[model samples]
Target: MTSEPVTLHLTVGLPGSGKTTLARDLATRTGALRLTPDEWMQPLFGVSDVDGKRDVLEGRLIWTGFRALRGGLSVILDFGCWSPEERWAIRDLAGLAGADFRLHHLWVDEEVRRARCDARWLEVPHETFPMSAADQDRYLAACIPPSADELAYAPIPDPPAGHETWAAWAAWRWPSLPRLDLS
Candidate 1:
């Protein structure tokens, strides 16, 4: 019997952009495992991204997601990857794990985004971190929206110079993820 192919879903956006909402919907619809670092960060550390802990946690989540993919289970990574390079790395890694990759890029008006963030903080104080308008502005400026080529799922470009393979680059990018021969 042939099992259905697994997929790796990526959510890309700034804070308050509804990444989590989209991820939850996708997970429910597809029975995909959803991995959201913020959900863990706030509950376990009582804060987010302090001293690079979030990065460490995300790395482990990515590794776990890959394992799920290998086991023929679809996974969703609810990470607001601000950099195109990070998105590319994850997409390529998903391919290596024999999973189809989908990138969900969410965008919203700055004012709406900020308002949503404010409301979320008031409603779920324990589940989220407070963000000032300034913080949203800064994060918005830093986020690099996916380009037309990316949205089209164009062939992935070669890894940045000196990186022999995407798996190698991924291992470097997320130290907790061990280099593997997923080919």
Candidate 2:
């Protein structure tokens, strides 16, 4: 019997870049499970990134996404995913889960991003954490846009040095994620 293909949709962007809006839309259209760390962080701990908690939460959410993929379900991870290494690792994880990977990169003018962040904070103070001007500037400077090859879904490159596999690297990167068994 032919089985349906599973997919992992990853959203990449700085805060206020409309990643969540796109993720929500994709989830509704595709019936994919949407996982957004911000939505959990606020209610769970009342703050974001306290003592590296966000990393822990993201690790668990990724594991959940992996399980859903293995069950032939699609997943959307609405993470800013600013770094290239993080994106690569997530793509590798999707491959391990036998799922196709798609990366969505959203971009907006700095002024517009700032304004959006301001509006979001004002409108839903409880739902979103406030983003300071310095935080926005730092995040924008640090964001690494996906290259053409990456967006094309090219074959994944080897894991970074010292890591035997992408799973190993992911375990190290997100300490909360257990080393996935390849068997």
The positional error of residue 178 in candidate 2, measured at the CA in angstroms, is: 1.0
Evaluate model 1: give its TM-score: 0.94
Q: lDDT tens digits, residues 41-132, model 1?
A: 99998987788888888889999999999988999999999887889899988988899999999999888888999999999988799997
Query: What local distance difference test score does each model get?
Result: 0.88, 0.89
TM-score versus the correct structure, for each prediction: 0.94, 0.95
| RMSD of each predicted structure | 2.3, 2.4
lDDT of 2 by residue, 1-183 (tens): 223368999999988899999999988788899999999999998876799999999999999999999998999999989887899999999988989898999989889988999999899877788888788778878989998888888888888999988889889988899987475
Error of 2 at 139 (Å): 0.9
Model 1, residue 156: C-alpha shift (Å): 0.6
lDDT, candidate 1, residue 115?
91
Worst 10 residues of 2 by lDDT: 1-10
Flag regions of model 2 displaced more than 4 Å: 1-4, 181-183
